[model samples]
Structures are given as C-alpha cells and as structure tokens.
Target: MATNSTVSLSMKFDRTSILGSGGYGVVFRGEWNNKIVAVKRIEKTNCENNKGEDALQKLHHPNVVKLYHVDSDIDFRYYALELCQLSLNQLFNGDEAQKNYQEKMPPEKEVCLQLAKGLAYIHEKGFIYWDIKPQNVFISVHPTDVENVSMKWADFGLGSPLNDRGSFSTTEHNTRPDNWLAPEILQMKENFNRTTPLRQEGTVKSDVFSAGLIFGFYLLKGRHPYGSQFNIPANIVNNTPVNLKAIEEKKHPMHAIIMDMLKKNPNDRISAADVITRIANIQ
Candidate 1:
C-alpha cells in the first residue's frame, strides 16, 4: 500500500535499530504496518523542500529503492523507505566473526546486469545518481534462495537532475575510496588551464564511470581497479589509465563494456542504454 504523505506522529511504529548514520542524516530501521521500513531523519536545514522525495516519487523500478512516505512539520523531515537486507558494501566486506555466517558474493554478471538496468532507468528519467558505490547499492535478502536475492539503488542524498550544474563543487575533495568518483569529477579539483568552462558536477557519463568501478570491484572481489598501494585521487589527476589486460584476465566477458564505461573522456564513454544492450548480449 502507498503511504499517505500526511501521516501524523501518532502513527504506530517501532524504531527497531539504527541502520546507518552519515554527514547528511541518520537512517533507522522501523516496523510500520507490520512491514519493515527504513526511516531517514534529516534536519530541516538539510532538506531542500524535500528534493530527494520529489526525485523518488515518480520512480518505480525493481532496482530502485522505494520511497513510501515523507512527513515534516517544522524543525525536522522524515522519509519512510523500503528496507533492504544488506548493502553491496556490507556484502563485499563481510564480517564472519560478527555475523556468524560467511558472506556469499553474487556472480559478477548478475550484479552488473541489475546495476546497468537501474542506471539506465535513472538516465532515462533525466537524473544522475551522482553517488554510485557499493554502499549505495542494496540487496534484498531471501532466506531460502541466494539466487532470488536482488539489488536496488538507494540513498539519493547526492542525486540531482541532469541539468542541475550546482550540485557539485570544483574545490571539494574528489577521489576518496568511499566516494568512487569519476576521473572527470576528480579533475575538476585540479588546477587545469582550460579554455572552456569545466564541469563541476557529474554527468550521465560520470555515473557510468563510477558504475564501471563498481563492476570492477565486484569482478576483483571488492578490490578496486586501481591498486590500493597508490592514492586514487593522484592517479586520476595524473591521467593513469586502467589496466585493461588485467581486468580482462579477471572477467573477460565484461572487459569491453567496463572499459568503455571507464573512459576518461566523458564524451567518448558509452551511454547507459548501450551498456544495457551489451550486458543483455552477454547474457
């Protein structure tokens, strides 16, 4: 059932546990209407007329996280969202000691296909998922069948429309491991003497680049395409090329598609639609 936008505080729900906390806000697990839900509480200052809610309102895709309700009064804003079992980051870096059971990683092809479909849909909707990392990719848990598990794109705090140029700043730190930012975004931080205006925020191709890195991480069992020994930001600024031969050796079938997505030049990168087609062909 669709959640009413005007739900009052009197609504019966139990806050189960804190899901996660970040610079933007805190996410909590809650039981509402006999269903598990994720409730994100953001300060009024951080909520820009509920932009995140507006972005997610019309979106309905299997690979996209569902937003059930948005409620606000004066000082605080709340978003009630669909609850997922695990994030791709959690699955990538499993803690057997804590969880008791060992984490089983999904097939690279399966992960790639789902992610591509989600990204393609976002692009088609004229929005850019500026942040596309394992942490933002969530997986639905199924007790009986691992293959039945599915992935969905979550966390729209950094998302913006394609034409929204002010979403990103050129002076900010660009290449943190947690960010998984594209080379173009990293380059914006560099002092380049360019004749034309540089793009401060991410474009569709920028999202594609991040998607490639995520795909590489999955193929290499959570290891980034660029080795951990070097600073990723420095490598990106220095125009260090990805080692395609090594990637091909690791996952031959996805080599071409991933390579195209990782192209340094955004104009030269393949479209999300093209990526979907390529993935479909391989499947």
Candidate 2:
C-alpha cells in the first residue's frame, strides 16, 4: 500500500502545487499524514467509475506509478495517489526546459525504441493502451544516482478489456481530446445528431495507429502529419484519409515506415511487433 495522510471532508487538501491537467480531471500535489502525495479526483454526476480508484488498483507495473488509495466522492472526497515531482510534459514544457524541447530535439530513434519496449509489455498481457500520448507517459517515481531513460505508461483511465468483445459499457466523455485520438474515434461524424450511438470501442490496431502518430510527432518536430493546431493542413483534407494523408505527402525517406503505421484502415495499421521491427531501423 502506498502512503495516504488522510484529509478530512469539508477540508480541501492543501494544494501545494498543481501537476498536469486533462479532460478527465486536474492533479494537485498535496500533503497527507505529513507526507507528500498526488491527489487526483474526478467528478462526473453519472460517472460509473467515479474517481477511477478501482481501475487504478488493478494496474501494477514497474514503470507505472503506484496508486496509494482513493478517497472517493463519498463526501466531496478526493483520490490520493503517489505524488511524483514532474511529468514528461513538465520536464519538456517548463520555462528553463521549454527552449530545449523547442530547439534541441532528442534522438527520435532512441525514444521510439523505449516506447516499443513499453508497448510490447502491455500488448503481451492482452491489453491495449488506447491512449499513448506523451502527457500520459512518465519517468522516475523517485530519482537514483544512475541515469535511466525509463518511462512507464501512467494513465489507465481509458484502458480497454481484451478478450471481452461481447461486453460493452458506456462511460461519459462524449467528446475527447482530438489531437491524439485515432481516426476511428470520430466514427459517427456522418450523423448530424449528437445522440446517435458512436462506436468508441477501442481495438489493438487503434493503439498501433496512435503509436504511428506519436512516432510521426517525434520524427517531424511534434508535427502531426495530419496538420494540427495551426490548421489541418491542405494536403490532408484533399482526398487521402485524415490519418494517413499527411504522412503520405511527406517526401522524407524515413517517413515510409511511419506512413505504413498510419494507415486509415485500422486493420492495416502496424502491429506491436511491426512497430518494434520498423522503429529499430531508424537508427
């Protein structure tokens, strides 16, 4: 069990600091039992998982951060998780370091190698990490003398159950962060009505497709081959499928491997082994 200094109801955990935030919830650095911990609390009136406490308990991995315990929304409750100092987002986005990420890019081949290792680990267990954005990956729960470029998949809030095709469940989030989402996620756009049933079911290939996108981001200076923040590039919107369109237009030699992974047809997206094999060649 991880540490949790109890914070009473009607008492807001002293928000010493804020970690990172996303659509699911915001994270804060708090003190409990006189010790530091990360408190993540999600509020959804119809949220079946509430604070995701149960799902957090089931995931145990060396690279994945540990969840101490949860303080449910039973009474304006908050979840208490292991409080780590920084996320890849912070390390890469902070003032002193922001320039580093902006100017000096890390070896794309090396980072892809590391991701391959993590992806392989999760896939072997029949699990698909539906979300694999840089924000969801973290390093060093605590530091050691030696330098280790180790990273673990941290957020399982969107974890998918393998071998359970017959089962389906509905959780909120009628909308998601579209930047990192794969093409299929927008499956029901053809329907003008928002209430129409949209198939958001995740598949292993979807994970692979997302991996290709991340690889594209890394190799292309954080550029989403599909065109992102600035505009969804002209070439991408013309005829080619959104996911593979930008990748296809690139004349870069290395992009060939990445293009294959970005295939719009999820069934054609590269597998975990294919990613490992192709990514290993970048060096």
TM-score per candidate: 0.82, 0.72
Residues 145-256 of candidate 1 have per-residue lDDT tens digits of 7557677998656566665652333322332343387876776646543444544666888889888888877676667675564666565555453544587775688988
Q: Note the clash tally of each candidate.
A: 0, 2
lDDT tens digits, residue span 35-66, model 2: 66667756544244532444456656665566
Candidate lDDT (C-alpha), each? 0.71, 0.57
Model 2 TM-score relative to the real fold: 0.72
- Model 1 off-target regions past 4 Å? 1-7, 10-16, 97-106, 143-146, 164-179, 192-199, 239-245
Candidate 1 structure lDDT: 0.71
Summing lDDT over every window of 10 consecutive residues in candidate 2, give the lowest-scoring window. 232-241
Weakest lDDT window of 10 consecutive positions for candidate 1: 166-175
Clashing pairs in 1: none
